[model samples]
Target: MSAAEAEAAAGSEYPAHYKVMLEKLNEQRQLDQFTDITLIVDGHQFRAHKAVLAACSQFFYKFFQDFTQEPLVEIEGVSNTAFSQLMDFTYTATLAVAGEDEAFDVWKAAEYLQMQEAIKALNKKIDEFSSLAARSTSKKRKIAETSNVITETLPTVEGEHVEIQVMGEGAIEVEESGAGGSRRRCKKCSGIVRRLRFSSSR
Candidate 1:
């Protein structure tokens, strides 16, 4: 792929929301060094560094708490619980949201939190959508290409000849004349007409 195309593809693979989260985390990092920050969810408090906290929003923390059903541990610096919560939130958001924008946002939040599972899941979902769109586009292109009319005339023995006209998506019409008389075929496999030709009148 060209550089532009590769960049575009990479952008598509990383959901928009995920990208935002990464930006936010980077911004937070620049503002302050990584320091423990407390997060409150469901009457419970969890501790993580400023970097991690900035990467994860309240929505993700709550989602993770609900999923774990247990009080998360507070590590000295960055907490594993925080990471787990981020991943759970991302997966949940992607599954719950109807809009691609929302899904992307949640994916980004997860990515900012440095949740591997969430990033992988988001990538997979994006890939699936991309594949579906490509297939649809391919089908449309094929339909357009096959809809044109193609006509061909072939010479035969004893002043007889055949004129073939193909129409529709894949329909073929053949008019043949010889000592045996004229014959016509429509989209049928004709072993006799081995060497078929096509041309555009327009």
Candidate 2:
């Protein structure tokens, strides 16, 4: 077998092992089994094991290792849902944030707790958002450029009369005294040749 195949086979062999371990740990946490610490956040109490938390979070590791033996620890500035999701992630290896706003909130909570994995997940989201924003900007720029070219290149002639019609948002239909004209269509602009038409699909 090739090295890549060997690696894939090896990975497949071990995938379920860690997943099962995480699920059992999550079950124990749900049952409050061998819980050593009680975390209070926004008037809500969460019972968890310090070892698991310390392993998952740098803040928890340092607090448990260097600080006092306080059984009840109060965390501030983090929302209930965010913290709940963080803890659920810490034990179950899953981050189930509802939407973008909640994902950002979880990111804040993860940053405060200094959790590398959750922070990395949030980083992926940020990268995805940046990519989407860049694509949108590029599309808008293309549309604007196309519109500018039509307005500037086409000069006012005596025979051809230009009529403007606003069909939809960012959509304009320019009618010239001509027929058999080729029509070009895109999300941002359409019928760009001869008789310029704007499409609102984009």
Candidate 3:
């Protein structure tokens, strides 16, 4: 168990203390100081504290528990970018990814490492991204549907000069030009209109 785990198991809640400790540990990692383990992923190297890794990841916890006199380990199946981001999360309890590829790699690495908390956070982000994409697609579909409805409403009439206007929010005014110059108005729209316009030459 790590020092943080011990503190948590003792039912102690020292947010400030834990924050400072993690900050210091991250600094040590940056300086390559006191890191007892070296992980190689896809030929990229990472130096980190084993206890911290064990505390954050079930895979790492078991890996070190069975490890004997091996300070260096080679990892497979995950990209280096993901492992780096997961390491950052382990130290600071936060992750910062600059792009989509980095985000995907981090999520993949977190799963492979069996980081439950990280996976929950990543899932939330995935939900948010999915919602955003859905909304955009819906808006585009609405616009296309509106255009198609207007085109369908306008039949092929010779010398047709129909002037259409939107009435309030949900109504429309249709004016037909001819000898009578007839006009039609409605309070509620049953169909969308506006995408079709009669050719001036016609």
Candidate 4:
């Protein structure tokens, strides 16, 4: 048949997860829901002879970015107390005005710990704030043909003491008078026109 159909058929012939890493990734996705182990890049969790609590704190801090308010490390699975300390330490460290090096260190630790969301946010912030040119180019561009309409009021003498006013764009005619109230009509379709009132007085 067609080339596109042939390519689609060929693609469906192969089995998914053909690579070893892909199989491991799928297994990790399954085990991630059940695992209690705290994996971090650095800071003694992986260190030999360190207390389990200390290692857990290091792992949580490094992976999760901040651990100050969290009870993650001491929970039964990961221990909520250790997690709290890690979170606290991370928050305090991140807030320090003079701790750029420490922040970078912690980021590295988090990266090593495989804290995916923290790594992504930190990287995004860095990229966004690093260059003025990049930041300027990232601004959204607005489309034309969408803008405010300017209405002009024209007064006409209708009767002895009544005055008529016409307003709005050339496509629509909105006629109003002190005695007759208001009337609207579309120039192109001859349809009845509707007047919309603004909420603000100004």
**TM-score result, candidate 1:** 0.28
lDDT of 2 by residue, 1-202 (tens): 9999988878755688889998988888888898877665654567899999999998788767754455655565677778888998888877666555677778877776779998888666655655665677777879777532211111111232222232332332222223775343322332221121212221
RMSD of 1: 31.8
Ranking 1 against 2 by lDDT, winner: 2
Assess the local accuracy of residue 27 in candidate 3 as a C-alpha lDDT between 0 and 100: 100
Give the per-residue lDDT digits (tens) of candidate 4, residues 28-119: 53344333333221111211112222343344344234333222121112222233323433323222212333334444434433444444
Q: What C-alpha lDDT values do all the predictions have?
A: 0.42, 0.64, 0.64, 0.33
Per-candidate TM-scores read 0.28, 0.59, 0.62, 0.21
Which candidate gets the maximum lDDT versus the true structure? 2
lDDT, candidate 2, at 57? 93
For each of the candidates, give the backbone clash count: 4, 2, 0, 18
lDDT of 1 at 135: 70
Q: Please give, for residues 45-95, the per-residue lDDT of candidate 1 as tens digits.
A: 334453344344453354344433222222122233333345344324334
Pitting candidate 3 against candidate 4, the one with the higher lDDT is 3
What order do candidates take by lDDT, descending?
A: 2, 3, 1, 4
On TM-score, the stronger of 1 and 3 is 3
Off by over 4 Å in 2: 1-13, 129-202
Stretches of candidate 3 off by over 4 Å are 1-12, 98-102, 146-202
- Residue 167's lDDT in candidate 4: 29
Tens digits of lDDT, candidate 3, 1-202: 9999988889956689999999999999988899987665554557899888899888778767865445556565567668777887889888677644455557766766678888777666655655665676777879877532211111122343323232222533333335875444442433322221222235
**Runs in model 4 lying further than 4 Å from the true structure:** 10-33, 36-106, 111-121, 132-202
